[model samples]
Target: MIHLVQIIQRFVRIPTGILAIMIYTLIVYLIYLAFTKYIPMLIHQTFDMIQSVIDFYEHQPKDADPVLQYIHNYIERNDFFEQLQNGASIALGYLQDIGKMAVAFAMSFILSFFFMIEKQKTILFSRLFLKSEFSWFFQDLYYFADKFVNTFGLVLEAQFIIALLNTLLTTIALAAFGFHQLLSLAIMIFILSLIPVAGVIISCIPLSFIAYSQGGIRDVVYILMTILVVHLIESYVLNPKLMSSKTDLPIFYTFVVLLVSERFFGVWGLIVGIPIFTFFLDVLKVKKIPNHSPREIDIL
Candidate 1:
């Protein structure tokens, strides 16, 4: 965001910190809009698709194809429509949590804004510990913290690019297949793509349902395949190259970090797991901190 702030600075002269926070607030606002709007669309599409299935099951001829009949019979026996209703209700319930997340995200940016504006004071005050008796401990702490920030910042930059690419590819694929509400879908994909492995799966489920409503099972299959291909490109081609250059970790290590972090820290872990692991590596002197980094703590 600070990089973006600098870019904007060329065209307009404004306080950098203020501009950065303005950008952050704008992003959060967009995310809030997505949570409010797209979620309802997802549920509505899902409900419509499920209702169509129920209608077909009800109105099908007595001599309908046996396999198809058997499938619809299974759906009925499982109380699938009722389950979908309950699921929709539960999904709606999550809107409260989404509100909380948006508030927290906004608050984090506010804190960051203050920190940016007070960077000199923050650094000087934080550096006072260098002369403390437990300076060794503080030094170690700063070492790890610097590594984490630098690596995390780089990964975030790369992730934004990856998310943008993923959104464009997914949108084009959906558009080619003649999907509807594509603007909403593209926004959701771009947001979810920031979340690593879990993001792909989370976005896929509702998207698949929406695709089903648009063009039945075949459309769902295409949507799944498109997501899979995009994810493969992100995980293998993009992430490995970017992360390996920045953190010196193999893709295997990255996956392990993600899995372990996800187990312990849930969703937040997927976002930070690689950075934390790289911090440990930097502490152990197994990974070298990149010379060009966004953090000032390293030299301090």
Candidate 2:
């Protein structure tokens, strides 16, 4: 044990310790910079969407006036008055969800700050605090933490890039369809992209309802078809291709995990489920647990 301790100390001596500290500091600084630049952008995009929706309704032609006769005619022909009421309800719910999401995301960023800072201390303390027989186990735990961070970051970066691209494409499609409140739709897409699997569908509901109210059911169907095609491309082709470039998990596994998480946690589950699963898997590897993919779960 003394010889092993001596070897460990010799390997990780002052210079190596200094290098680790420098690397950790660099990472924390980069994270801070990223958070600073993006948080305001996200907030701006959200408010812009809400404002656009409000303005669209505010400026709608007043009823029964000849100059606005076309809108009244369309609205009556499609019986969109009732639909508009329903849409208002949906929009209100979406707005509330957006507010909640903003709060949750802010909290996550704050939590991550503490987690990142305490990580090195946790590593050191584990070694010092563990029994000699369990010292190697603690070292394995630290190594797993590093690997999980690397994996999680890589997945998040790649997924977010795909999400941004999809948002851009979808916004263009909405404009092509002549949908009002284009910016709002785009922002919704961007926010939904953070969620896995069902995010797109959930985000689409309010936008599609608004589209239906303004245009008609047929127009809504067309928009839905377009969005579905985009989602197909995203789920089957883009997601797998991007994820494969980084990790080897099968597409079925991702789908199954998303389903289970959604069943359990609703929207929140969809956002955090896979990351949590991966983190647990990494920990299981550290602890030498037998593992199964999400597919094998028997909900019955």
| Best model number under TM-score | 1
Off by over 4 Å in 2: 1-138, 245-267, 282-300
TM-scores for all predictions: 0.70, 0.51
For model 1, give the 10-residue run with minimal summed lDDT: 290-299
The local distance difference test score of each candidate is: 0.74, 0.64
> Which tens-of-lDDT digit does each residue in 1-300 have in candidate 2?
112223455777643344445555676688787579865676676566656655654466555345245654676688865786797898888779889987997787566545444645654555574446776676667556555654565566657777887888888888887775565567678878877666777767877766755566766787788778888888778877776544345668767888898899876677667766766666666323222222111111
**What would the TM-score be for candidate 1 when compared with the true structure?**
0.70
In angstroms, give how far residue 227 of model 2 lies from its true place.
1.1
- The digit string of per-residue lDDT tens for model 1 on 1-300 reads 556666687899987667767787797788788679977887676455556656766676787656557767888799987897897798677666577887998788778777767766777898789878999999888766666667666767777788888999999999899876676677778878876666898899879766755566788899999999999987779877765566456557767888999898766677767667766776677867674554443348
| Residue 70, model 2: Cα distance from true site in angstroms | 20
Model 2 scores a TM of 0.51
